[model samples]
Target: MDEMMPHSHLPAVGVADDEPSLAGVIAEDVAAWCRRLSSTLLEETGESLLGKLRAEADILRTLVDGEGSVVDGQPQAPPYRDRKGRLRNQTNPVTSARNPVAPPMALVGSDGESEFSVVLPIQYQGPPKTLHGGYVSVLLDETMWHAVRTALDGISFTRELTVTYERPVPLGVPLTVRGRVTSTDGRKTFAEGEVLAGGEVCARASGLWIAPRR
Candidate 1:
């Protein structure tokens, strides 16, 4: 958990005005910082960086609550003391996706819905630079249901999922997934997702999600 390793190489932050410009600079800095953070965590923990990250999220919570600084030019408020209080809570589903954790995919722009993209590396490969089918399903399911959760507020789980692959999802290439809820019936939610490469759809998915039973 050496914070220095990931962020040390990042460009020094300078004062900037407005959100857009500041976001661009902060994005670049965070990317570099994440790289260092991942490498350092791997070296020290002998576990996936995502695992270390989850373990340290509480500490990050404290820092974010105490400091309340601008991240990527967007001002963020303090962290919630409990899961119910956080703006976006990923702990439950993230824990469900255990065995091998999914990395924190970036939140791209949303056209009235939620969109995200994740870059798979050699380590994430399943078949000669192709992403594993299971991981693909996980990504699609998580993003699709998360879109619903983002728009509304509730705990949900995938009840059923159907994914169609038009082409093999290549590794090392950025895979973009976008999703939105089509409709909801009480505890059940229906959603759809599209996986894209170079702006072309490679795979599409539809899912039925249900609220987790208490």
Candidate 2:
């Protein structure tokens, strides 16, 4: 019961083409087919391999993409790295990699603080290899609303969060999430987070954000 759920900083930006485009290689090939169907939906046991993964998601949902195949102007902005922050969030599904139910995130420090890393495969398990206390409280309520929207870049909304599990988060390793902003009043804002691994600290969080009125 790794009392789960989970940033600070805003100075690690980078990404000016240099490479990867073609819609970032088709959104990392659909986030690597959603990390290989989230690790084969947690180690496929049977049912004819889960009916061939629902018949390959119904033949990849007919190769979606329409509306004149978008691309008429802007709205593609894809850049997300956290360790050496190079951020951007085209309709976040946690850094949407074509939103394959998102497990994507690579945000890193900047301004008020933020950081990321997650490895919750095994279908985001729970009680066994851990992680799944409401998905660690929505990963500490979306990293305390992206640490007050990347320190007042705008938008925020997690009016409360308070996780506190001190251990047991080990489903395939890597786990480090952080958030910041420990103050602010009018329109309320206050955040905190933690969920380390090898370096200890299992879980910790604190939040209450707002920021509506413009």
Candidate 3:
């Protein structure tokens, strides 16, 4: 068990909590507990405790306000919506507490390459102590397309996405995500991405992005 005692030396999730970013961070923290509750229920919760959790969840659901559309100028994209300064944006299901797939928190960072990192937690597990394949695919696809928004002009949509799992990505670890432009043919943009854990590649993806006529 100690071998999987978590990568104790990993850096903390790096995100600033400015006035604009506060809400997103709060949501991330809350989502984390949701993940914990889910996994715990699967492992050790009994019927009584499960009922209590359901009641609590229902209460929270009632409190939730409906989501509105993105503002006039903000980029409207799939997988997540772009917010001015929020890391855990309410508009983004990947980082939103209200969404089932969101991790507790993910830290976005760059290393002189066209890539970012989202710190994952145990809540996003599939195989024991490993990240789920579906989440991995989305992470690569969304991140790659998001990266494309910067590299190309006009709104781009994911025409195709291909993901290859290199290794088992550990839960509760920082994963480096990168998407880079390889070339372009007319309105088509070609990009490639990879996810790395502890400096080792875990997944790779190639995507085709297109600018559809309005």
Candidate 4:
């Protein structure tokens, strides 16, 4: 609705091949198409296409069980080292390219303040054409965490978070996210974040974080 911020443009889904696994990007494309298919009317051709895709998925399921850990017979992702030899989480529900459910909110800037943006697709919808309230809170919490991480220069865990929903966030629109540190008290840090859509504040959140001792 309103003009997007400078440098806030998100890259096309599945185009993020810079991450460790090319398969992750490919999976993002597949997941996106699956979401599109969910919103489409199924005709004869569509049903036939689904059959083919199911067959291929069965093959993939067999091939992937070897990589990650198994718990209760389900494979779980494990942390892996990146090109720089830094260990990275296997998947992050908010920002990891490997997780299909992620709006994969992108961080654009963190110079004293943190800024992120995401375009929620059909899969993230709750009530007609609006994003799920839970996800709005997730974005706010994550943005606040980034604000604390950047400002405090260390890892911290959220102690408490409070969110207020001001308006319904629509699906398929770019939403601006912003967060900043409000103050610090010894090991405790405080921050707030807001999600804006169409130039209006759709939701706001404030959080307290506890930084681990160095």
Query: Among these predicted structures, which one has the highest lDDT?
Result: 4
Best by TM-score: 4
lDDT of each: 0.58, 0.66, 0.60, 0.68
Q: What lDDT tens digits, residue by residue, belong to model 4 across residues 43-160?
A: 2257777786676566456435433323224112333555565655445667755455566677865654798988887667789899899999888877877887777765677788
TM-scores for all predictions: 0.55, 0.39, 0.61, 0.67
**Candidate 2, residues 7-104: lDDT per residue as tens digits?**
22222334464434454545555555667776776777689678979976864553233222233332243555665445543445555555566676
lDDT winner between candidates 1 and 4: 4
TM-score of 1: 0.55
Arrange candidates, best TM-score first. Answer: 4, 3, 1, 2
| Native-to-model Cα distance after best TM-score fit, residue 94 in candidate 3, in Å | 1.6
Model 2 vs truth, CA RMSD: 11.3
RMSD in angstroms between candidate 3 and the native structure over all alpha carbons: 11.8
**Order of models, best lDDT first:** 4, 2, 3, 1
lDDT by residue for model 3 over 50-165, one digit each (tens)? Answer: 78688757645542321232223232211222334333323344544444455523434332125566776656779999988988887776566656666655567677788889
Error of 2 at 155 (Å): 16
Off by over 4 Å in 3: 1-33, 46-90, 97-100, 104-114
- On lDDT, the stronger of 3 and 4 is 4
In candidate 2, which residue ranges exceed 4 Å CA deviation? 1-21, 50-77, 80-101, 104-122, 128-138, 149-162, 165-204, 207-214
Q: Give the lDDT of residue 152 in candidate 3.
A: 59
Return the lDDT, model 2, position 108.
Answer: 75
Candidate 4 global CA lDDT score? 0.68
lDDT for 21 (candidate 2): 48
